[model samples]
Target: MPKADAESPQAPVDPRLLRYASASRGFFVAIAAIALAQTVVIVAFAWLLTRAITSAIDGMPVAELAPTLGWLAAVVAVRAALLWAREAVAARAAARVQTQLRSALVAAVGALGPEWLAARGSASLAITAGRGLDALEAYFGRYLPQLVQTVVATPLILVVMWWQDWISGLTVLLTLPLIPVFMVLIGLATRSVQQRQWQTLQHLASRFADTVQGLSTLKVFGRQHRAAASVERVTDQYRRETMRVLRVSFLSGFTLEFLASISVAIVAVSIGFRLIDGALTLAVGLFVLLLAPEAYLPLRQVGVQFHAAAEGVAATEDVFAVLDAARASKGSAAGSADSHSPVPEPHPAVPELVEGRLVVRDLRVHRGGGMLPPLSFSARPGTVTLLEGPSGAGKSSVFAALRGAAAFDGTAELGGADVRALAPSQWLAWAGQQPGLLAGTIAGNVTLGDPAPDTAAVSRALDLACAQALDPALELGVQGAGLSGGQAQRVAVARAIYRHLRGLAPVVALDEPSSALDAQTEARLWRGIRSLADEGATVLLISHRTSARAIADTVVHLEPSEVPA
Candidate 1:
C-alpha cells in the first residue's frame, strides 16, 4: 500500500511567501509608494517643528504659527489616509492569493482519487484545508506587506537622517542590522515550536473527527468511556503544545523588543553626547532624536507581526506537502485498452435500448496485500449473473474492480469495450449494500441531483422496487435517516432501476440489494431485477443468501476469505 508520505515533523517549506512576492508585486509597489509618501510627511513634520521653534525663539509673530500647524495637520491627515489605502490594497491582494491557494489545494486532492485519500485520515485533510488556511490570513494580509515596507522604507529614512548628520546616520546604520539578525535567530527557534504545535493540532483534529463519526458504534459496543479517555489524552497533549507555542511567541516578541530598544538607545546616546559637546545644534539634536525612533519602528513592528504570522507559515508548509503528494499517480493503471479484437462499429446491436453485454476474461484483482484469484464469467444481454459468497470473499471488490478502482490484473469488457476503458459514466452502476442517499424527499434521493425524474418514470421505479410506502413528498432526513432499513434498500433499488431506464448505464451491479428487505419486498426486488434483464440490460447481483441465486441465469461462487472482512 502506498502510505501518505511521512511528512517531516519539522515545518514544511511554504512557497506561498514566494507566491505572495510575485502575486503581490503590485501591492509591493503600492507599499513602496506609501512609504515614500510617509517619508515626505515625516520630513515635512520635522521641518515644520523646526520652523515653529525657531520662529518662537525670535518672537517672529503668533499668526504665522497657525498656518504652519494647519499645514502639519493636513500632512498628518493625508498620511493616515494613504496608510489606510495601502493596508486595504494589501488585504485585497492577500484574499485573492488565499482563494487561489484553496482552489489549487482542492483540485490537487480531487486528482489524487479516493484510493489515495483512503490511506490518510480525514482530520488531517480537514485541518490542512480549513483551519490551516485560516492561519495564513495574517501572514499574507499584514506581515508580508509590512516586511516589504520595512526593507524599503527603513533605508530611505536612514538616508534622510544621514543628510541631517552623518554621525547619527552611521549609528543607525550599524545598529539596524542587529534587529533582523536577532529576529532571524529567534524566528528559527520559534519555527520548531510552531511546527510541533501544528502537528499536535492535526492529531487532535483527527482523533475528534474519528470519534464523532464512530460515536454510534462506540455506544453500541459500550466503548464510550475508552474513547473518551483517548480523547482526553489527545486534548491534554494539545493543551501542552499550545502553551509551548505561546511561550515561544512571547520569547520571540521579547527578543525583538530588546534588540530594537538597545539599538535605539545606542543612537540616542551618540546624539546626546554630540548635543552636549555642541557638535549638534539643539534643533538638529531634537530632529535626530525624533527620527531615531521612526527608523527603528518598522523593525519593532516586524517582530510583533512575525510572531503572529508564524503559525500560518507553518500550516502552509503542510498544505503544500499535500499538494506535492497529489502530483503522484493515484492508481496503477494508465488508461483503458480495447478488449475486443477489431472493435465493432460505433453503433452496435441495440441502438434504441440501453442494454449491454459483459465479458470478463482472466480477471485478477490485487489489493495492497495479495492477488485475488483470477475468475472469469460473462453475462449476455437480457441475462442476470448472480455472484454468491460468504462475507469477505472479494465479491464487492469485484464490483469495485469492474468500476476501475485499484490495480487489477485482467480484463472486463462491457458491450465489447474494456470495462477499464469505459468512462465511469459509460456502462456501469454498482450500487453498494448501503446506498448513498442525500438528505431529500424520495424523488430527490432517487434523482440524486439530476433534473427531477418524470413522475411516471419515478412511479414505475418505486412500484417495481415496492417502495410505495415512502411518500414522494415526505422529507428524508440527512442521509435518508427517516427511512427504515428496508425502505432505504428499496429506494436504492429504485434508483438503480431509474438509472437503467434513463440509459445512464447498461450494466448494473447490486451488492446485497436485499439484505435489509423483508421476504415479500425481496421478492419484489427480484422481480425488478428480472424486469431489467428482460429489457436486455446486463445485471450482476451479489448476495450471500442462497435464495438470491434463484432469480439468476448463472451463479459464480467466491470463497469466503476472498472478500474484505
Candidate 2:
C-alpha cells in the first residue's frame, strides 16, 4: 500500500539496469503493447455496457441488446487474456534479468579478484546474488508491469474521458495531482526506512553466516550462547523494521485509495447532476462515470505494487553499486590494485611462460592498514629458493602479492616481465596455507582449469605431492571435507604441481606446504620439491623448518616489519 514515487531518488529506474540486463528492454515493449490493448478493451467494455443499459432504459427488446451484451463479454475476456499475458511475460523477464545480473555480478567479482571481495565481505555479496536478486520477482512480475500500465493506460483513459465529457475530465485532472503529491511526500519518508530494513537484513545474514562458519570456535570458547543471542537481537531488529514498513505501507495504500475514491465520487456526482439536468445524454454520462475509476486504478495499483517491490528495488541498488564499481575498475589487471601506474598487457614480444625466473625488488606488502617487512630475492629456473621467516615475517604476504590476493609496493617480475602485467595463472602455480578446494572428485580438483587433463600427469603430481595413496576417483565434500588436514593439504599441493606438470605454469610456489606433515613425510615433500626444481621448474618454498635450508640454492631470511632487514 506504500505510495509509489517517481521523484524519490531510490525509486529511479536505473538506466544501468537496462544496459546490464538486456532482457528487460524487450519486456518493456511487450508490456506496453499489452497495456495499450487492455486500455482499448476497457473503453470497449465500458461503452458497450453503457449501450446495453441505455437500450434497456429506452424500452428496447432483449433481442436488440444481445449484441451489445455479447460484445461487452468479448471485451472482458480479451482484457483478462491480456492480463494473463502480462503476468507470463513479467515472470519470464524477471527470471532472465535475475540470471543476467547474477552472472555479471559473479564475473565482476572475479575481475576484481579477492582483494576487493576481502574488503566487501563475500557473505553480503552472496546474499545480494542469491536472495537479493530473487526478490526481483515482485519488481518485474508486479511492480514494473503496474508502472507500465500506469504510464500507458492512465493518460489514454483520461483522454477518452475528457473527450467524452470535458467537465469530468477537468475535475479528474485537478484531483489527480494529489495522489502523486502524497506519494512523493510519503515516499521521502519510506525511502530511508526501507533502506534500513534492507541493510539490517544484510547485517543479519552476515552475522548468521559468520556464526555458523565459526560455531566450533565459539563453542570452544564457551561463547556460543552469546553469539546466538547476538543473532537473535539482530533478528528481532529486522522483525521490528519489517512491521514498521508494513504499517507505513498500509497507511500509504489507504491514503491513495481514499483520494482515488473521492475523485471518482466527485466525477460520479457531477455526471449524475448533468444527467438529471438534461445537459448530458445517458450514454455519455454513463461512459464518463464508468471511465472515472479506470483513470485512477492504474496509478493506485502502481503505488500498491511499489511497496511490494521495495525490497527488490533496494537490492537492485546494491547490485548496481557493485556493477558500477566493476565497470569503473575495468581494464585494471588484478595485480595492479596497489598502483595507479599503467599496466601493460602481456605483449607478443614476451613468450608465454618464458623462463619462469622470479625477481623481487624492494617488495613491501600492505596489510591491515600497514606495510609488511621489505623482501627481495631472485629465484631462477632449475633452483629452489628457500624463503625462511618467522610467522609474521611477511612470507605468506609475499605469496599473496604474487598471486594478486593483496596490494603491495615494489616490483615482482617473472621472465623479465612485470608480474602485475600478467595473470598469476599464466606463470605461477601456487598452494597456500589453506587447502582451498571444492566439492569434486580428486582427479577433477587436481586438474582444475586444464581443459584437457592428463590422467598420467595427475598420478605423477599426486606422487610428487605425497598423495599417491589417495585415490584419484575419490569424491570430496565441501571444502574437501572428506580428507584429513594433512591429506587435504597434500591434495592442494598436488593440484598446484599438476598445473606445473601440464606446462601451464612454470613456477611452483608453496606456502608451508608440509605444515601438517610428519617429519618423515616432510622430508619426502622436500625431496619432491627439490626434484621438481632440478627438472628446470622455478620453485619458491616458504617454510619455518630449518631443515628446508638444505635443499636451497638461495636461502633468503626475512625480518619483521618493525625490525631491521
Candidate 3:
C-alpha cells in the first residue's frame, strides 16, 4: 500500500506544503498583497461607475461628467492589469514550487535508499514526481489566488455594503453561510472520491509500466494477451474514477452557483423595495446593489476553486509524507550521533581481525520483517571469497546489508573499521544481479562516479573484466538497451573493476556476474576475477556455478533458509 494514501480536505492550505516547498511561502505573501489591491480596486470600480451613471442621469454637463467617466475607465484598466499581474505571479511561483518539491522528493528517495523503495513501485513514484506535481499549477496559480481573494475581499466587501445599506448587507450576511455549508458537505464527498481517483491513476500507471517492462516474459509464456487485458481493465477503472470526480466537481459548481445567485437575488430584491419605498437614497442603493454580487462572488469562487485544487491537495499529501519521512530519518540520525550511537557490533572482536580483512561474524540480514539465518566468513586483501548458495539462500541479501540497503544484526568489518561506519562507496565497488546501466557511452558507464575518468584505465578495466570486445566508445540506449545481457553484465563488472583499480574503492563485490556469459566468456571472466585478487584487491564474488570454486580462495556456502511467517 502507498504511504500517503489518504486525503485531508480540512485545511484550506496545508502548513506542511509551505515547509517542504519553501518557494510557495513568498508566493502566498505576494498573492495576499495582490488580493488586497484587487479588493480596493473592485470597490473603486463600483463607486466610479455609480458616480458616472448618477451624474449623467441628473443631466450634468458633458464636460463635468467626463472626469468621472475617465476615472471609471482608468479603474477598469487597473483592475484588468491587476488580474494579469496575479496570473503572472502565480504562474512563476507555481513553476518554482514544482521544481523545488520534485528536487526534494528525488533527494529524499535517494537518502532512503533502494531497500525502502523496493516496496513502492517505480511507476507510482514517477507519477507522483511528474504528473502529480504538475497538477499543483492549478492549486498554486488559480485556486490559491482565488481563495486569497475570498479571504481578503469577501468580509471587506460586506463591511462596505453595511456602511452603504444595512438591509442589503444583513441580507447577504444571512445567505452567505449557505454556500459554505453546502461546500463543506460537498467537499467531504469530493475529497473521498478525488483521493480514490488519484490512487486509481497510480494503479493504472503501475499496471501499464509493469506490463511493458515484462512484455517479453509474458510473450514467452503466451500470456501477453492476458497482460494486455489486465492493463485495459486498470485503464477503464481509472477512466471511471475520473468521471466520478468530474461529476462531483460539476455538482459542487452547480450548488455554489445556485446559492450565490439566490443570495444576490435576495439582496437585490430588498434594495429595490427600499428604493421604491423612499427608505434608501439612489446613490447608496446603486452602490450596495453593485457591491452585493461582489461580496458573495469570492465565497462562491472559494467553494469552486476548492474542488479544482482538490487533486493537487491530494498530491501534496503524498509529497509531504515523503518529505516528512526524510526529515524524520535525518532527525533520527542526528539523535543517534548526539547520544554516541553508531551501528553497534554484537561481539568483542579479536584484535587481529582489525586490519585489511573483510570479516563477518553471525550476521543476520533483514528480509521483509524477518531475519535470515546467521552466517559468517572473511575475505582478506588479495583473495577471492565466494558466497555460494541456492535461490532464497540470502546471498544477495548479504551484499544488500553491506551497502546500507538492508539492516543487519552482528558485525561486518573491513580495513579496521565497521562496514556500517563507512560509506559504501568508500570501501565497496559492487555490481548487483541487475546490470544497472544507464544510457551513455560504454566509457562513461564504466567510469561512473569518477570525477576525472582516466582514458587509459577504462581500456584496462574492460580487459580485466573480460569485456575487451565491447568498445569504450559504443553508445547504448536507456538501461543499456543496445548491448546484449552478457555484454551489459560485463560492462557492469568493468565499472566495479575501474572503481577498484583507480583506488577509489577496496572490495570489488560481484553478484552473479557471469550468469549470462557462455562457457568461453565465463572462463575469461574467472581469470579476470583471479587477476584482481592477485593484484592485492579484495574480491567478494557471488555465483551459483560450481566453476566459480576453482578461483575461490575461501568458499562460504549459505544454507537455504525459509522466510519467517
* Best candidate according to lDDT: 3
- lDDT value, candidate 2, whole model: 0.86
By TM-score, the best candidate is 3
**lDDT values, one for every candidate:** 0.74, 0.86, 0.86
* Candidate 3 residue-wise lDDT, 303-399, digit = tens: 7888777788888778888888888877887788778876643233323221288889989998887899888888898999999978888899999
Q: Candidate 2 lDDT, tens digit per residue, 59-85? A: 999998888888888888898899899
For model 2, the superposed segments whose C-alpha errors exceed 4 Å read 1-8, 331-342, 346-350, 561-565
Best-to-worst ranking by lDDT? 3, 2, 1
lDDT (Cα, tens digit) per residue for candidate 1, span 1-565: 2222223332222444455235556666777777778777877777777777777887877897889878878988987897788778777766766676778777766666544565677677778777777777787666766776687778888998999989889989998888877776777766666777777788888888778656767998999889999989988988997888788888778877787788888888888898899899877877777788888888778767876787777666766666666654432122111443332222333332254468888787777688788889989878899998877677877887877566577777766666544444456666777667778789987766357577777777787778877787778876677887778878888887777777777888888988987787788789878887888778999987777777899999888665443
- The regions of model 1 sitting more than 4 angstroms off are 1-60, 325-354, 416-426, 433-442, 449-466, 473-497, 560-565
TM-score per prediction, in order, is 0.83, 0.90, 0.94
lDDT preference between candidates 1 and 2, better one: 2
lDDT of 1: 0.74
lDDT of 3: 0.86
